[model samples]
Target: MQALTDLPSLQQVAASLTEYWSPRVVAEFDDSYVKVAKVHGSLAWHSHEHEDEVFFVLKGHLRIELAQGAVELPEGALYVVPKGVEHNPVAEQECHIMLIDKKSTLHTGNVTTEKTRSLNEQLRPL
Candidate 1:
C-alpha cells in the first residue's frame, strides 16, 4: 500500500502566492482545511454560522475587527473567531496567514463579495 505524503512548507507555499485575499488550500486535518493566504488591505466583514475560523499569523501583522472590538496578532500569534460572530481581517502591509476551518466553510462566510474565492479556485496547485 502507498503511504500519504507530508504537506509542503507553509513558508514556501505562501511565498508562491502573488495575490492578496485569495487563499490556497495546502493541507487538510480532520474535517477542516489548512489554508494559506498572502494578505494586505482588508477583507469584507462576514460571519460563519456554524464553524469557527482560526487564523494564524505566519509573517507580519494582522488585525481582526469585530463589531465590539479588534484583536491584533503578530507573527506566530493565533486567534479563533467563534461561529456567528462578525469579523473582518486587515493587514496594513503584506502578511502571511494560515487559516484552519471546516472544509465547507466559505471564504467570505455569509456575505459574498468580490473577494470571495471558491473551493475550486483554492484547490489550484501551488
Candidate 2:
C-alpha cells in the first residue's frame, strides 16, 4: 500500500500541468474521481446526462453560466452542477480547479465544443 507522504503536493502537481482544458487525475475511488485542471478563457456549454459534477475552486475564481443566470465561484467555494442542466464554465484568467464526478461521467456531455476532452487520462509530470 502507498503512504500519504508518497503523494505529491497539489502545487507540485499543478506546476507540471502545461496544457489548458486538460485535467490531470489526482485521485480516484469506487464512486468518484478527482481531477485538477488549469482553465483559462471559456469552456464548452454542456451538461452531464446521468450525473452531477462538482467543481471546487482551488486557486482562482470561476464563473458558471447557466440559462437562468451566472454564478461566480471564488477560491475555496464548491459548486455542483446538476445533471441534465446546461451550463458553461468561464475563467477570465488562469485558474486551478478540482473537479469531482462519477466514474463513468464524461468531461463534456452532448456538446461538441472545442474544449471537449477525454476522461480518465493520466497526466504525468514533464
Candidate 3:
C-alpha cells in the first residue's frame, strides 16, 4: 500500500514470500493492483487481451518469453508486455518480482495451470 508515511517494505515482503508462482497483493492504486511473488520456474503461456502487464524484477533474474523472442531482466530491471501479446515468465533460479496489473487482471490470463492463483487468494491475509 502506498502512503504519505509508514510505507510498506517490499524487501520485507519479498523475503517472507515462500510460494513459487503465487502472487500476493501488496498494494493498489486506482484501478491497478501491485503484487509480489517468488518465482522459480515458469508460468503458463498466456495473454491479457485488455490490459498490459508490467513486471519488475526485484531479485535474481527473470526471462519473459514472447513468441518473437525472450527478454532477459537482471535484478532491478522492468519490462512491460503490451496487451494482446502472449508471454510466459520464467526464472532459471529463484527470483522475486513485483507485478503491476489491472484490478480485474487474471494471473493466468486465459489459461489456468497449477500455479494459477485467483484474486481472492492473493488478497487473503498475509
lDDT of 3 by residue, 10-70 (tens): 7678778888998999999999999999999889899999999999998999999999999
> Candidates sorted by lDDT, descending order?
1, 3, 2
What is candidate 3's local distance difference test score?
0.92
Pairs in clash, predicted candidate 1: none
| RMSD of each candidate relative to the true structure | 2.4, 2.1, 2.2
Off by over 4 Å in 3: 1-8
Q: What TM-score goes with each of the models?
A: 0.93, 0.88, 0.93
- Supply the global lDDT for candidate 2: 0.83
Error of 1 at 30 (Å): 2.0
> Per the 3 Å backbone cut-off, how many clashing residue pairs does candidate 1 have?
0
Best by lDDT: 1
Of 1 and 2, the candidate ranking higher by lDDT: 1
